[model samples]
Target: MSDICVIIAAYNAEATIAQAVTSALAEAEVAEVVVVDDASSDATAEAALAASDGSGRLIVERQAQNGGPSAARNRAVALSQAPRIAILDADDFFLPGRFARLDPDLDLAADNIVFVTPEHAARLDPTNLPAAPREVEMLDAERFALGNLAQGVHRGELGFLKPVMSRAFLTRHGLRYDERMWLGEDFDLYMRMLLLGARFGLTRAVGYAAVQRGASLSGRHRTADLAALEACCRAHLEMPASPATQEAMRRHLRQVQAKLLLRQFLDRKAEAGLGAALGFALAPPARFLPIAKGVARDKIAALRPPAPPRAERFLLPV
Candidate 1:
């Protein structure tokens, strides 16, 4: 019997939902594919339904209201019964024989992800995957937190890696996605599971292709959403953790806070003027440095020429 149930939370993803569904259904290890349509005004649900092979493996559910990705994912999980749960974004897909690359015994398992333009992704061949076996790295809570930190243009954030999780482990720990968070929710859930001593294994084998879009949610974040993520980090810090984990958490918190501060400054500047932004930045003594550095980076970037886009990119775990 297949052990994995692939779940997708889609919103206004009619353009790519069928591709995502077909890719998941192609994997032999996937017993079922559950897609939750978050009340999209488009034909996302219809597209997903059309991709079904009529094998009863594809389950599509329409939400009563437009909930965020977290809420939609939670709903999909409730409708799935497989031992393992794999998250497949509406704009991303799994490669053929992807589940065979990971160790199923581990509590959580992930593989390398390749980023490609939608056009390139359509022609991507599964036979191009390397035949060599890859070594698996075990991740500790501290290491996981540290790897998610943003390093400017070098965005090899571990938060982007979608891992296959043991449903039993999640149920045993009483853990679910934070419904309030539309951003950083995956990272938060994975971090909490790691803190609970969940064994997370990662392999360098390429098994997933994440479509890079200019309008992706990861690229367009609201200030309020970022602030909520920062608050979540603070709450995580309050929990009991090892010295190393605590330090890593602090660093992660600082990064989130920095981003939030920068966003707030930008919003204030846009709403009022430079003077209002400066006043807001100065009101909290800690916000000045991040905002200043952010402004400097923007100014420097504006002076440089734009670079050409790439056909394919890889974001390896740091």
Candidate 2:
């Protein structure tokens, strides 16, 4: 088997599963591509199966019943034999040289596995762009979570939650994506990985490109997404973290609650929602104070001026 297995959990993804599978198979480091059809009502399974080369490099199977993305991904992992795992959405495909540049065979060094970051292609959502570029970034799970506080919102899905990790790291910690969650599942899983002592090193290699479709899950389930974010924040608050990290989670909780309440107010002018949003605004959540200080400390050593602005890449499907 190759060093890595790409686990793609798909549901009713007939139009895109083929691209996802084919691109995965093109990667030399990939042992195989496992596309788990989550009981898709359409021909997603057939499309995924058709994408297979019949050379035993791709496996397309369907769940007996519809399970969410987390369950589907876990199922694929259980069936995968490679030590490292990477997730690809059915609508997305890997970029050329994704795994080769990541150098999966390198010694784990002080970390667990080599993490490759993706540069999102702007097929539909142009606002989604890469944050880090031109360098391989590294951080512990807690530090990464705290660093995210600068964004002032729960952004678990912006490539933070998706990283190529060794299967052993997850198995050792009994880690799995949240099956019960409808939103922010990525954030919850990545946060939990940090809480369980995962040290990550990241690369800015446009590893994969996921196409955004009309009325995606985030667009369809706004309310549920907010609830999941709040739930995720609450769950993280109960875990062990530094005071700064804990406070950041608390701030994120308030932001989620505020957003949830405002959305409800807009839908139906509820007094409770208005009151809750006001309550969150009045309280101090300690936003990025500690992280900012650390950043300032690091900047003091930089003698060179900031880099000049460069053109950003935005890929669209033909």
Total backbone collisions for each predicted model: 0, 0
Off by over 4 Å in 2: 103-134, 146-161, 264-318
Q: Model 1 Cα displacement at 190 (Å)?
A: 0.3
Candidate 1: residue 224 lDDT (0-100): 78
Give the top-scoring candidate (TM-score).
1
Q: Write model 1 residue lDDT over 1-318, tens digit each, in one string.
A: 489999999999999999999999988899989999999999999999999987799999999899798999999999999999999999998888899888899999999888888888989886875554479999988999999888765447898889999999999999999998999989999998998889999988889999888888877789978988998899888878899999999999998988888999999999999999999999977779988998898899999998765666767732
lDDT of 2 at 116: 20
lDDT of 1 at 132: 41
Candidate 2: clashing pairs of residues:
none
All candidates' TM-scores?
0.96, 0.72
lDDT of 2 by residue, 197-254 (tens): 6756555545555454453564465666667777777888888888877776777667
Model 1 misplacement above 4 A: 129-133
